[model samples]
Target: MAQDRALLRVEREEVLGYLLLDSATVKGDSVRYEGRNANSHNDVDAIRGIVRSQVLAQRMERDGIDPKRVAAFARFPLEMHTQRIDDKGRDRGVQLGLIFLGYAVALLLYMMIVIYGQAIMRSVLEEKTTRVAEVVVSSVNTDILLAGKILGVGLVAITQVLSWVVLSIAAMKYGAQYIFGEQVQAAAVATAAGSPGAGGSPGLGLLAVGLPPVPLWATVALFLCFVLGFIFYASLFAAVGAMVNSQEDVQQAATPVMLLLVSSVIFMGPIMANPGSAMARTMSMLPTSAPIIMPLRITLVPVPWIEVVGALAGVAAACAASIWLSGRIYRVGLLMYGKKPSLGELARWIKYAR
Candidate 1:
């Protein structure tokens, strides 16, 4: 029994020695091994390589452990530390600009889609009811006619958004003195204390506020995303308008789509409030919800580069899918003139193109 106990202890010690060389599970003493057999050799080789590269001789002479090894284990790599600083700076800037731009762009998009979408619906109904659509259809292909109308109206909507953005920026710049009087005064006071005559100097406070600034790049990216998102939704709206013969019918069809947009927007608010939340992460990846969610995410969260790339890719794919679906509906709904189609008929439209 004593001999058996001694043999088991020896075996355990040998096992421990082998495992101590394993990079994955080399931490202190361990009871259970938890690594794959496949990469064990490679991991061991890597650990050996790291140990070899470490200047242990210099470490013994200088600080007992090589400064490089100490840094490697105790502190982040210099490149990584620099990158972290850069990232923090970027995140701070993004946080400031994102809040301002997200709200502004969201409000503008909501207004434009609602207003111009209604116009498209009304125009479609009027054209069809007055038999004007029939005349136009005779002269031009339905597809071309529909594309032209959507493009023309979309261009107008784009113009309105641009105008609003410009006017809003101008108003904020000129009206800051009136709107934020106390804050500006406090800033000026702080500035004067630091540099006595700096107060009376022209553009001193303005310089303090930061010039050639205002997150223009972030705003541009947000606007481009908004435009793409709008195109995706508006195309569906146009199709729905084509399907319905009258204003009342269009309203019924438009309700679902509008509700979806509203729900996406509402969902965006929560995501903005906690951009790092799991729900926000999931929603941002979804193409249908991404347009609304991504901007909000940019505002509240530090979205990883990979996530941004993946989300944009998903949005592009979804846009392609939406376009395909919209084309089918547009093609079928353009020729139909009577009662509105049922859900079943819509299903048939999917197969119409197929």
Candidate 2:
């Protein structure tokens, strides 16, 4: 009777073992066969089934895919793939083109305005100290002499500005793509599409647009403003040089003018941050500060026609006043030398100089 019960228990366990083995095989067909003995076979099959199911569950968890929950799977990584450009010869050619064109233009403009303007002032001062102006005045009218000096210096500055502009255009045409990169090009295109008649930004977009596509009217306005501003400052610088007997005196006299220029640039940060503010509007209309402020306002934000006209008129008036003042100072001081003139003396010179 005992032997019959043991045999029955063994038979029931065999049936359960076979079912577990079949399930394990379905999940993974790499299950190991322990032996043909009934007890050994049953233990191996049960262990294999449990192990396989646990591994599958862990894998699902790691991938954020729960067995009991439904979710969509990502088909690819979350980064954009782009092909690299490997045209070494083309890249080299573009780089050289940019160096020759872009750098040349920027350097020329700087040298013309800053370097030559200083040269004019120094020349005037040297001639005045040496009393050469008295001899020149005997042969030529004072106004004629002034006109010749202004014209000669102005021509040099103009030539430099033109050369730079030409070179900059050439650089943009040849090497802009390589310099600015693909992302910048895309942004420029997007910006242009959004803002019609605007030359998006300075870097890549400026290069891509070249010369023809730029806003001609705006460019012309800026150029005119720059010319007027330079003339006004240069005349003042020449007058200051004449008033002083030495370079040290010239430096002291020119401090206020330099400060004015520096202050205008410093204010640009705040103006740009809040373009529509009353402060910005007022500063933009001031002749002394308008050259820098007006251009920034027009380029960065929506500027009203009235403000533009007001700024232009104010700057033009200031330039005219500066020319008159400079001419008066030059007429009197260009013959005086030795000691630097005081403020009171300068006022008298302007009041009484023929």
Candidate 3:
């Protein structure tokens, strides 16, 4: 404490805070180091790696253990290569950005799907409750009404998504200039131009070396995915809204459909981290998750053409199925009122409704 105080005075530095290790023990390869979370986690982590290792080594030598033998207990430096995943030479900053980007895109897509899906449902419920559907169904087809509602709501979402894409790109460009300076930006641009498919990083040219923008192709793909994905979910929302007699029942009926949407987000962290693993590939293909999951791979890396095609096909088919089932329910449920229908009845509606 005296030496630290003297050093602080000599260096003309102010004491901010201090850390005191609570406990440490070493006995025959059994090592324990206790720390408080109030200290930064990095500090605690570093203690385990550096400080504890040093203490263990010194104690081992004091106990007459060979220095090399004590050193042998240090954590081994290991390299692992995962199948089909390439992270070589990618800057940590770029990797972090990709992770964040995937998460952001996924969060945005999920919100839009849920928000607008419920919006479509609410609109349907309003129509049904107001007896507007009874009047409209007299002329306009329910399937047509459902499609039109989805299209209208989906178009608004697309406009917002496109605007965000454009602004984000512009902001990222300016951010690179502000952060990395013009020379680095120019160099990145040059690298990106020279390398075909570098957009997989969706970054500035060799932007991984700097900072990257999402590629134009990925933006296009994102728009298309959201469109079809919205249709897939929105149809179900419309169906749920049509089935329930009152607003109280709306949420209860919607819960199961909402669960499917929620389930997609559960795998996001793992999918974004692996992106090429079987889990990622499978999630990206399933209609329930593909809307958000496929975009992650589309933006981060170049997925195989076959996988991309298959993923889109699966989502498209799911959309068709959802529309078909929802349309049938909408046809029957729009008129039937009073009590909430059971799962069995809903199935019968699907089976028998023209």
lDDT of 3: 0.69
Clashing residue pairs in candidate 1 are: none
lDDT of 1 by residue, 94-209 (tens): 12234555555565666677778778767776787787877887788766776687788889998887787677667656666676666656655744343312354434354334
Evaluate model 1: give its TM-score: 0.64
The digit string of per-residue lDDT tens for model 3 on 79-165 reads 111111122222222333555576778888999999889999999999989999999989998778878898999989888877987
Per-residue accuracy of model 2 over 292-340 as CA lDDT, tens digit each: 6676655443356788877888888888888888889888888887788
Cα lDDT for residue 62, candidate 3: 76
TM-score of each: 0.64, 0.61, 0.67
What residue runs in model 1 are displaced by over 4 Å at the alpha carbon? 1-98, 178-183, 187-217
**By TM-score, highest first, what's the ranking?**
3, 1, 2
Off by over 4 Å in 3: 1-93, 175-217
Residue-pair clashes per candidate:
0, 1, 6
Residue 120 of model 2 has an lDDT of 68
